[model samples]
Target: MHGPDVSWYLALSGLMFTIGAIGVLVRRSPLIILLSVEIMLNGANLALIAFARHFGHADGQVFAIAVMAVAASEVVVGLGLIVAMGRRNIELDVDKLRTLRG
Candidate 1:
């Protein structure tokens, strides 16, 4: 028997990416933005794995792994910046952060 088509996976990925993009654009909190970025990364990962499986190649999965590594680093850096701002007693709001000169 045949399995589900690749388009379904791609559609789901698109939906996820759209939601994440909206969250990133519409939210004001730094933590929320970071979470949105993570969501977008996961969507990309899902697409990559889906395509890899469809093509019967390991490259997509390998790239997904690399993407995951980069995503993790992104989270670490994003959280670090947020923590730094917190330590400095700066507001966590993105609009307020734009005034930061340093």
Candidate 2:
């Protein structure tokens, strides 16, 4: 039995990325947008790991780990903003956040 091909992995990553892009474009809630961005990041990480395995190199895996760290930081910052908005009684709607001008 043969292992899964790289093209299969690439195709799955592409599909996941497309779904994430759609979620980002179509969602209205700030939290949803953040989640969608995380999805996109995960999709990219999936591709990186897949390529690393295919190429038998560590660079892609290293970058994937870096991406994971960035994603974690993103969640922290995004949730902080959400909590701040809640404390300030700001709406969760992304369209209404335009008034946040300092």
TM-score (C-alpha) between model 2 and the true structure: 0.92
Give the lowest summed-lDDT range of ten residues in model 1.
Answer: 93-102
* Model 1, C-alpha of 66: deviation from truth (Å): 0.2
Best by TM-score: 1
lDDT of 2 by residue, 1-102 (tens): 178888888888888889999989999898999989988898899899998988899999999999999999989999999999999998888877665661
Best by lDDT: 1
Give the range where candidate 2 is weakest over 10 consecutive residues by summed lDDT: 93-102
lDDT of each: 0.93, 0.89
For candidate 1, lDDT tens digit of each residue in 26-66?
Answer: 99999999999999999999999999989999999999999
For model 2, the superposed segments whose C-alpha errors exceed 4 Å read 100-102
